[model samples]
Target: MKVSTRPLWRKATLFKGVVVTLASLAALTVQASPAAADDVYGKPVGGAILVKYNELDRETGPLGCPTSIELDNPDGVGKRQEFAGGTIYWSAASNAHPVWGTIGGKWGALGYEGGKLGYPVDDERTDPDGAGKRQQFQGGTVYWHPTLSNGAHPVWGRIGELWASYGWEGGVFGYPTSDEGWEEPYQSMTQSFSSGGLTLFWSPGKNDETSWCKQECVGYSGAAGTDWFKETRVETYVGTDQVKVRAIPTRNGFNNARTDFHGAWNQVWSMAPYPKGINQVEHRSLYEQFACHAAWAEERLPGDWNTGPTWDLESWLPSIGMEKAIDPVEARKHKCNWT
Candidate 1:
């Protein structure tokens, strides 16, 4: 046994050297392979985009699989990657957000993150109505609904703010039907919506104004006991000035009788109470009283007033010399009910 001790030592050293070599090779192979080599889709996805992709459930989720490696955004500061279902955009400020479907198409048309909309801050989400979808971006929001033939539309800037005031998709506007557009005549920015043929307009140095047509004429006979009249109402607002013209049928029960009209009808125009310092007396004598007088004068006429025709109240108010009666500045202060 003593004679063979040196041979045994050599064998032991050889075995240790082989084990170390194998260990080194194993580490090298691991280093050479992709970190995210799980590549069930055969494409390499890594970095923040990869993390988002995984969050979305990768190949099994709605995003499907990565169709392309992460690419540089035009802005150079951001990165994006395309997938079968959508694209994920990543920026240092916005982190990562997935935009897809109609909303994605609209955003792309608006120039992706390069256009006015900038980067998306949140993922695409279902609207409160549940049927529509909306996604928030740095500059604005894009909305989509299956029922809309025009696909998706964006609401942003001052007009966007006004839409938000009216309650967004859940409000009177429903969903935007068109993107922001220019109205050469008014020299204003405009956007249309799905509800009541409503459109919002914004001009330089002015608050938002809205114009909408009533789909049907509704009858109203305020507390004054005046003859019931059907009004085809169309409202147009400019700054704080609101002009509501009711085109009433002259052939109602008061055909032969006449009433003295001092101003607009005695009706509660605002659901909310008037602000402080503005009492009901001033609201009636100044705004509604004059508006009512104008309507009464219009009713006396024989042609369209008898037929329940659609007329412009703002334009008519001036023709009757009652325009001064509608003090837009005072009207803003009072919040008069021009019924």
Candidate 2:
């Protein structure tokens, strides 16, 4: 085979064009109104920025200011910026996950509205979601990072185990107990996430002995300097008349190992969000439970509602309308245009 040497700038330009073209096409496909015939060709090509990030966890903490990259020849107006993507990893943060593709154009920086897209928090607005309410996570695949090479595990189990399966089972840890406090015991849980590094800990019981307790079911010690100890806690949140949630702890660490139950620390499972229809109490409870859990977790371990001091979970946030945007990149890659 013969190879021709091409200038680095020429190659970069070529690669950028292909990506921008594909992204523009994707945007056209999803646009509510028909795209202009010459929209992609009419304008002078410009540059656009594609931001990449890992799913937020209690570990990675805040990714900081919105990632901004420039691609050429973008089109559209929202918050007056180009395209915006949100946390989309849970399923494959450490594996070959989906990627999102967006067309290059000029518009205000994308931000998160109540549910709508807004600029990054660091930009201006302090509110979490911002003004928009559609609450849609846009951008087609082409953004997810492949799983890490070598041996690396996730700190938490699959989102399903935390939300769908109800509780943990198998040969996973039971409950850890100590002289200070304790963790509840139920079924063992053993799961291997696509990410192959961080260890995941869970309790696996919804309504066990206590609403929240240490791993070994122990109580606070009346000692001095170092009285507090790690424990397990299982709590549930009921929403309107259609939602309920339970969280437990199995073990906690960036790496895997035999957990002591009560001593090992880390959030295990988080129940899936359910609809309340017309009930506000349940809705409130749902929010309360998650907030309380976030708060309690802040005290026991190292975390926060927005970002964690000890852990990072922004990458794995379980927003409602996420799956729809799961793997645009993969979807487009294997999609048969004619078929």
Candidate 3:
């Protein structure tokens, strides 16, 4: 759309019954919002500018300075003005609203008006539940949940698409607990939602748009340097108090196999019991090669906390009929949404 370069943008429709509303608003005698300081090539006017200025408390509007003059979109779709703090967007159907801050930043990253989310249908504000912040875009809404380490993060795109399908905040996922984080192993980004009960993971692959898992899953396979890396994470306990002590060897790459424990040079696993129990797990050790042997593994002793080169865990694969290590391993992907 074509946006006017002028400071004042006049629309035939806004001149209609809006005059009565503007006059009534003027009767309030509230302080008109002051014009922005930075992009001040022109002085602020009185008529339509005053109405918009008054709509937002002068000097107190969410958007501070008028970075760009109010103008009609080239497509003649709506009205908009850029500001220091945010932008005030107006549509006859949706009215005028401010899109700013974290939500606005994310909207910009998604391409603003040119992005999938066409326009700001409404302002950036809290949702009905008051759990987190919300902003409406043309295609969809962007939501921000407070982060423990950082202030907050944004969740958008296909993840947002899936979130909408799950019933938004009211869905089983509930409000987001953390912003998105990139999983180097999976070549994906995931965000915690539903108070960590459910996690939404989004992959770059067009087909693997989004997937929800309880705990982070390095996954069963991926190419080297992709999402592949051997790990034995105790994902979750049987319940709340019990440490069921579950351990499973996961395929680190797409070429991972039962016989080949280490696919790429990028592989290792660790176990600690020293000061707590007394054990050590390090590669190039006896245990690292023979871990598959239940008897050999159980009989072995753990070393000091920082000890290394413990036991041999090799050839255990072929002993168990696993000869080729380049074959595909089973894919047993788990879910974070499971009860």
What Cα-based lDDT does every candidate model obtain?
0.61, 0.26, 0.46
Q: Which stretches of candidate 2 lie over 4 Å from their true place?
A: 1-78, 81-118, 121-143, 148-208, 213-339
User: Which model scores highest in lDDT?
Assistant: 1
RMSD of each: 10.0, 26.2, 17.7
Looking at model 2, residue 78 earns an lDDT score of 22
lDDT of 1 by residue, 234-290 (tens): 333434344444434335422432243421133222111122233444344434443
2 or 3, greater by lDDT: 3
After superposing candidate 3 on the true structure, give the runs of residues whose Cα lies further than 4 Å from its correct spot: 1-53, 65-67, 72-78, 91-94, 128-131, 148-167, 170-194, 201-339
- Candidate 2 local lDDT, 235-301, one digit each (tens): 2222112222333222232222112222222233211112214254434333333332233332345
Sorted by TM-score (best first), the order is: 1, 3, 2
Worst 10 residues of 3 by lDDT: 330-339
Better of 1 and 3 by lDDT: 1
Writing each residue's lDDT as its tens digit, candidate 3 over 199-301 gives: 5555543234342223322211111222433232211111222111222222223224233444422243332110111133222222332222211122134
Could you tell me the lDDT of residue 57 within candidate 1? 91
